[model samples]
Target: MDDTDTHLLRLLQHNADTSHAELGRQVGLSATGVHKRLRRLREDGVIKRTAIVLDRAKLGLDLMCFLKVNFKNNLASPNLDELHGAVSALPEVLECYTLTGTNDAIVKVAVRDHVALREFLQRFSEAQSIIERVETCIVLEEIREGNDYAVPKPQ
Candidate 1:
């Protein structure tokens, strides 16, 4: 909303565990003021939800891949809801997005290994009958992965 609010959000983005007092100290607000502002931000939908970021490799999920999917049926005639539901039901799929190119959708997936990846792909193929082709690119290294977004400055 204001400069102080923007600053608070930036601090929280870096570390959601920041105490109200610490946030207040950095933003020059009282502890109660900081708490109230944070509550207001949450109520106003400025802050969606807080979550913990995990290390995929540490969790034994060593494979990360991007899948480009194309449909056999005419794009205008396909059952979009059923297709979306099928993709959403897969646990290995981390994210999926609609595209404007030759492919219909791009999906980010994570699995334990190549064997698991094959099984996941097999299930993916079975999930939708309209699938024409799927191209996969495995990630060798992830330099950065985060949900951070640029916070606009108050005018």
Candidate 2:
């Protein structure tokens, strides 16, 4: 991607709701040009679906935790895909990452509170057929939108 594409991505990442005129001004393109590029970006999958950032706490997800999961076997093993698929299907399981460490996979999960977390943990733990073990860290704060101005500052 060239500078314009990079700039577009940074801008969209901050606020997908930005008007084409506003996006054009920041990137030094005409609105029509910006619109075309944005379309192409979406068609080519350079840009995924635009989304809004929701307030997690307000949505009843008062807790944010990262779960480091250790599987009983390696992903390359023939039977491991079924096990991983099961883990991924759990709605509470958010982002899942295959890792290179003592842990086999990492996931992000959010819940209402400690009690709910404990309940979910117990259920997952008891499912000895798929999960091996998990470690979780409660997030206190996060910087999700700091790259806001990394693109051309909205003009």
Candidate 3:
């Protein structure tokens, strides 16, 4: 990834719908050149699938909560994969991360209301063999939320 490649990535990160010709104009490359670079980036796995960002509230997912989960055993335990599979299968789970220190994992979930939240918790409780305890925090408001990332210059 060179400077031009990084610049293209940054532009695409901001708006995936930007035309190749426009990107080329900004990055000083031809449309075909821009297309080739983007193709290479996708093939190299540097660029993941492009997706549209949806409004959660408008989609009826009004409640957003973060769940801090503590596992019953070590992270290296055999049941780790089982827990991961289960979590990944949940559509409500927007993000799940393994963590160090006190919490074993943190899960970001979106639901319709308190009833849906409770239902999610009930389903989560089925994995109690690996999960020791869970702490929940409801997001009252979202000041800013985005998945955009800054593309760093190549070393």
Candidate 4:
């Protein structure tokens, strides 16, 4: 992508609600040109689906914990797809990943309280055969946030 594309991404990241006209002005392109560029970006898979990020506390997810899990056997020995499906189905599991080394999967779990988290942990430990052990750390605060692009400084 060119500098124009990077600028576009930054604008969208800051506020996806930006209008096509405003984007054209900011990116030094006409409205039609901006539209065509956006279409090309989408077709090339550069732009994913636009979504709204909700506040976890406001959404009733008061607790957030990061979990590391180890598998009983080789990476592919257990059904990875099935494990992913099962974990994704749980409302509390926000994110899960397959990794290298001692651990198999890392998960982000969100719940209401310590009691509820412990209950979910017990259930998860009992049901999944591939999961050998799990270690969790609670999120105390957000240190850095994600940004889709970087804004240029004034000359």
List pairs with backbone clashes in candidate 4.
Answer: none
In the range 20-126, model 4's lDDT, one tens digit per residue, is 89999999998888888889889999887788777888987888998888777747745586577668668888788888877788888889999989988987776
lDDT of each candidate versus the true structure: 0.89, 0.75, 0.89, 0.81
Poorest stretch of ten by lDDT in candidate 4: 146-155
Which residue pairs come into collision in candidate 1?
Answer: none
Query: How do all the candidates rank in terms of TM-score, highest first?
Result: 3, 1, 4, 2
How does candidate 4 fare on TM-score?
Answer: 0.86
Task: Tell me the deviation in Å of residue 153 in model 2.
Answer: 16
Q: In candidate 3, which residue ranges exceed 4 Å CA deviation?
A: none
Which structure is stronger by lDDT: 1 or 4? Answer: 1
Candidate 1, lDDT over the whole model? 0.89
Candidate 1 lDDT, 98-153, residue by residue in tens? 77878888889999999999999999889988878899999988988877778999
lDDT of 3 by residue, 1-155 (tens): 99999999889888999999999999999999999999999999998899998989899999999999888785866657867886877889999988898898889999999999999999887855688889999999998798877667999
* Cα-based TM-score, every candidate: 0.91, 0.81, 0.94, 0.86
The alpha-carbon root-mean-square deviation between model 1 and the true structure, to one decimal in Å, is 1.7
Return whichever of 1 and 3 wins on TM-score: 3
